[model samples]
Target: MRFIKLFCLLISCSFISPQISAQGNKNISATEKKILDQGLVDIQSVNPEILVELKYATPDNFMKKNVYGDLTHAYLQPEIAKRLSKASSLLKKAKPGYKLLVYDAARPNTAQYKLWDALDDLKIPARQKTQYVADPKIGSNHNFGCAIDLTVVDEKGNPLDMGTKYDFFGPLAYPRSEQEMLRQGKLTTKQIANRNILRMAMVHAGFTVNTTEWWHFDGMSKKQARAKYGMIK
Candidate 1:
């Protein structure tokens, strides 16, 4: 009888070991889980059709390094996710073949510092770099989970020519300067139209585009977001 009891106990331990191993190896920390559990919602849960690349997760961004590490998902505040979904839906209705392609969302504060440090160009003053990347001290709207850097992609998932590439730090990337860039032969009329399509869809869904960067959009006013949410650590 004792031998049979020992055999049963060994079988139970074998079954439980996998569960313990899985729990111990989970990627999310308690703090990150807490953040997800609260005000933030995974954009994939809200709209899986929305294409998310998360440039910082790969080495493709301006930093030229993977700052986001193993994190592959994009999370935004609940309202932000809804607004992004609405924008994508509008884009789909306007152009059945196109979809919103998110490049970055809900950036962590540490990532901001890494970006800041990467801008080691002595030619560009510290003040100017802050214009492109928010000062870590002030924090960015993305850090508050209220902003997204995105563009429109075609049926083939190729990014539409939005005049300038994502994370291009130049006046040509500015939406407000589109005409100037066009006159300079830097941006073609077709590129401008593509940008307008994205802007119109996002604006119709109540997202405000930043004048400086064509791909950047905010779900809420910066003042309101700053007052309401703490920067993601």
Candidate 2:
């Protein structure tokens, strides 16, 4: 009778194991599962008001390739996610119907390598390439789940005119050159105001904007991030 009871228990366990596994992964892809495993929180889960449009997940980015397969959601460190949520709130309070639109976040080092390879194929010099995509060898703040690339969007979901497209790799995209670009008629006052709105929200929420990329912001310095968390492999 004991042997029969043990046999029944084993049969039940076999039936339950696959069900549990499938349930856990029902809506999550391998890449998302990995990011969650590394302790990154999904931004939408933190603040649904903040829109996510992962450019690398599609071919709309500068690379012009879909490097982030099955990774549509943006992920960030828990603290960083909270900061992003705060930024979203601030933007809503200031602009009423405006929302923060995320372009990219918490990139895997593997994706970084793919971006590097794409630039390499284009014959872009290594030094110049670093300005756009960080070298995978050293890793980026995104790899540490401490960075975000985002913009402001109106209630209609149309992105504000920030002078250039999200991934425009040129002087027009450089925040440092915004004044010069404006003086030279390359950027309009309204464009600079739009960019400033984004900066105000993010900077007030404890993020620092990148010098070259108006859309890029760091939740913490790279050195600080490296000390706090391991890079997302």
Candidate 3:
């Protein structure tokens, strides 16, 4: 979300402690860097690849607090940049005027703390997990600058309907909705169509969709996707 104003509350996701959160940019490794570099070289811009906007935060929902690098100016590592470079070509190949909005990129999962804050503004509930646990804090792929939260925008720069708002995390983002009425709460029929347009385009371009979050996609394959990946956090 450019600014989905979810409320602010600190809850430790797992062994992921505040001290651990302080260890910023932990997902980046040397090999990942190599992939990013070469990936960029192969990345091709769609017909009219362009950067319409680059929003960092909206006062209440900030992402740079304890993460790595500057939050105000988002980053896409190298691989992601490569993938997006291909997105333009992919979109233009599929349909003219199809564009992507890069909402969040290269943000620490701790940045998720701010993302949750925006959930309230969008009426999405935050997972009520307890303060601490024994989980390994695998860390967000964003630490490696691999993950991003965004949606398809029209040539005019308006967000298309995808049955629900980006990052909503509710039942709608599930990517398998059979409920037509459920769509009325947020997106309309035309919006959903536009959403599918983008989703389909992404799938054809070697990206994998997150079952629970339509706006969340990664270029990593099934094996590489679960390679116990970590960044420089």
Candidate 4:
């Protein structure tokens, strides 16, 4: 409950972001503007073809201390959206059944999106922060709209547990982590098998999995990853 509240606060403040520091927003290409005119930056409408999986969870361990809240369900910047469409289109082609699960959309409060400070409060070590902290200096890929945090869900809309909850910060959430499941022999092999289904799909879509966060994927396109990444001025 406490985590949820802080998570909400963070999202409410951070979701309406516009590259606070100017950063590289000024360089918006004419083509990018065309995408914006069509409302790529904002949620035009939920894609009916795509399944609606679990939305952002503030109470979740990785984001529990977040004061910036969740932006996955919020409005996106047009410049970023255009690129996302390109990324998503390719992803869908690579993995037909898989869909993008956007967790953090656009941060209205980029300041509150401090992974390091949040981890420190959670008692995570300094060295570990580098591995987890969404660096504000370079900014997160989520900020650029090229990256997304996502997982698979069943036809019933229930999240297929992939070892741990989405955004869970521990080793158990690692893609290749040997850590045991949370419950003592609760979920069966079949459930885990389903979870891996999503992982395999993501890999097929040219995404590189994060060793720590199973829900995370770095989109395969080098062009997208290299360009329009940092949002801070």
Q: State each candidate's clash count.
A: 0, 0, 22, 17
Candidate achieving the largest TM-score: 2
> Model 4 misses residue 45 by how many Å?
4.0
What are the lDDT scores of the predictions, listed in order? 0.84, 0.90, 0.51, 0.51
C-alpha lDDT (0 to 100) for residue 68 of candidate 2: 96
Candidate 2 or 4, higher lDDT?
Answer: 2
Please provide, for model 1 over 75-185, each residue's C-alpha lDDT reduced to its tens digit, 9 standing for 90 to 100.
888888999999999999999989988899988888888887778653567778887988888888998999998999999989998877899988999988999989999
Model 4, position 104, has a per-residue lDDT of 52
Each model's TM-score?
Answer: 0.85, 0.88, 0.59, 0.59
Ranking by TM-score: 2, 1, 3, 4
1 versus 4: better lDDT goes to: 1
Please write out the lDDT profile of model 4 over residues 1-233, one tens digit for every residue.
99999999999877643532222333444433433433435433423344323243254445444344332233344544444445455556655555555555443225325654677778878777767756565565554544556655444555555656665666666656532553446445665675566666656555566777766666534356447443422
- Give lDDT: candidate 2, residue 184: 97
Report the lDDT of model 2 for residue 115.
86
**Lowest lDDT 10-residue stretch of candidate 3:** 127-136
TM-score of 2: 0.88
- What does candidate 2's lDDT look like per residue over 16-114, in tens digits? 534225334347788888888888888887787889999999989877879999998889999999999999999999999999999999999999999
Q: Alpha-carbon error at 70 in model 4, in Å? A: 8.9
lDDT over C-alpha atoms for residue 161 of model 3? 64
Regions of model 2 farther than 4 Å from truth: 1-26
- Residue 226's lDDT within candidate 2 is 97
